[model samples]
Target: MATINNTPAKPEPVLSAFIKAKCPRCRRGDIFASPTYSLSGQKMHETCSHCGLHYEREPGYWYVAMFVSYAFNVAEMVTVAVGTYILTGSNSPWLYVSLLLGIIFLLSPFNYRYSRVALLYWLTPGLNFEPWRSADKPENPQQH
Candidate 1:
């Protein structure tokens, strides 16, 4: 006869999972249908593979992702500007703008997916780094 181990499993980090495009709830499901860039652009899964978390909250839920995308764009611009200034000691405004534009254009697809993932993680109230594995029923079961 064998005894079973009852120790709970370690939960995956939410930030790391988001960066890897995994579901915020279980941290194991793949958020995107395609691993990388796709011919038809980035395709996202409707629901989590491991858990039953729905991707879309409502019709215009993804509009919030636009703000997240804007934030990412601004950050990317600042980073590129600083990097270019450091690499080439020429403090030209044109150079900074050109490099920023190039970098943004190159990373457009990444920005789109990242923004969506960020919003998904943020919009879900009470989301934790640890997996939400409670046996208790929610206050409102109908509001998923």
Candidate 2:
């Protein structure tokens, strides 16, 4: 008889899981409570109601989010700089700076939300919420 390994496979990190509009916890949960957005951006819920996963670990923890934000900003600048140079056929300072700033501002909100969520998903590996399956129903539904 051959021995079989029974270890369960580890789940993938949620940060790199999906780019859709869903909470990293229970992919079905909504990150934002309302569809409205302020001058800044969409307001995200403090915690995931479905799985009770907190968005922020601590107040100061968000400071690290700036690093992620910076990386995104730099990438945007590089992309815009290269595109501007290619499109205009000249290395104009005005065009470079203007395009850089424009891309930065345009992508800021997306970067902010993604960075925060990525960090949260990375730090909380144990918060993975598996979806309920109809085929795997409880033996006694009314026991609780």
How accurate locally, in lDDT, is each candidate?
0.74, 0.62
**So what's the TM-score on candidate 2?**
0.68
Clash count for candidate 2 is 0
Q: What would the per-residue lDDT of candidate 1 be over residues 1-144, giving only the tens digit for each residue?
A: 111374334555666777898877667778898855667888889987766678888798889888888999998888877777788888788887778888888888998998889887886566543344311221334557
Give candidate 2's error at residue 131 in angstroms: 4.9
Candidate 2, residue 129: how far the Cα is off, in Å: 5.2
- On the 0 to 100 scale, the lDDT of residue 114 in model 2 is 72
RMSD of each: 5.3, 8.2
Best by lDDT: 1
Clashes of each: 0, 0
Candidate 1 stretches with Cα past 4 Å from truth are 1-8, 91-94, 126-144
TM-score of each: 0.76, 0.68
Single out the weakest 10-residue window by summed lDDT for candidate 1.
132-141
